[model samples]
Target: MRVTIFNYGAGNLFSIQAALRKEGAKPSVTKTGSGMKEADALILPGVGSFDQAANSLPMEEIREVIRSGKPTLGICLGLQLFFGGSEEGRAKGLSLLKGRVRRLPPSVKVPQIGWNTLNVERENELVSGLDKEPWVYYVNSYYPETDGKWVVATSDYGVRFPCLVAEKNFYGTQFHPEKSGATGRTILQNFLKAAKK
Candidate 1:
């Protein structure tokens, strides 16, 4: 299926493209709204600050995509951008999910870089074929503290935070599955399969 990886000038688009292709998906990366609107599935990937990523894109079209109820996946800053607001910036997001992003406290590393294992909290389509303690790559400081229902997985560093999230047509991961090897591929494959449904 054709999947468009959002090319909003911040994410590691080529790596995400490679990951999708590895999952047997015919994927393309673009910054245009029309390309995004016509894709069978869309992936929002980001690799920078919240405000830089937010202000650099067409927010209205993105909101419309989420509202369309088609399958969409977000990663890292892309995931953080789905929230109402982020402590990383004063600007607002698509608010597709109800929550605010906050930076991890100084107790641990600011970026929280490297491999960490995520514990599946609820049975969801995202981690369907993955192992119980899946090690995923991460490079972020801020995360969403979702309420009870939306959380699909949790990972601990200095403290536990939402790692995988799913709500209807929308899905997000705080970790980078593209960089996580086999376990990461499983997560992306699951997303591709779920989008077909």
Candidate 2:
């Protein structure tokens, strides 16, 4: 399948593109969110901050496309942008899902880098073959705060927050699947498999 990744300025394109290619996907990167409809799937990488990423691109088109169920995968900051807004900045998010991004509480270390366990809350295609407690890599200080309806799995830092979310064709991972080793590959494979059908 052809997967298009919307790069929000320096949006870790290499690693994600590599991941996609390893899964036998024809992946391409676009900075302007151009030619999204032509691809079988879309991706929003975990790169810049909320304000920088959202303001740089034409969000209206991207927002509607994902909402239309184009089979999307969002990572880290990419996941945060799915919400309505963020405490990270004044810029508004895609609001594809109703919620807000908030800074991680001071109790735990900020920028929860390295591997963290994913506690599966329910079964979903994104986490279809994942181990019960998969340790995924994360590098962020902010997280999405939203209704539990979309959340399929969660992880605890300073607080328990959604680690994997799936609503309609939109799937988001607060942790980086590309950086999560074998478990990550399975998740990506599942997404590609689902998009094919």
lDDT of 2 by residue, 15-104 (tens): 989999998899998888777988899998899989999999778998888877799888898899899899999998888887789999
RMSD of each: 1.3, 1.0
Ten consecutive residues with minimal summed lDDT in candidate 2? 4-13
Candidate 1 TM-score, C-alpha based: 0.95
Best by TM-score: 2
Provide the lDDT at 98 for model 1.
Answer: 79
Which sections of candidate 2 miss by over 4 Å?
none
TM-score against truth, every candidate: 0.95, 0.97
Show where candidate 1 strays beyond 4 Å: none
Residue 122 lDDT (model 1): 93
C-alpha lDDT of all candidate models, in order? 0.85, 0.88
Top candidate (lDDT): 2
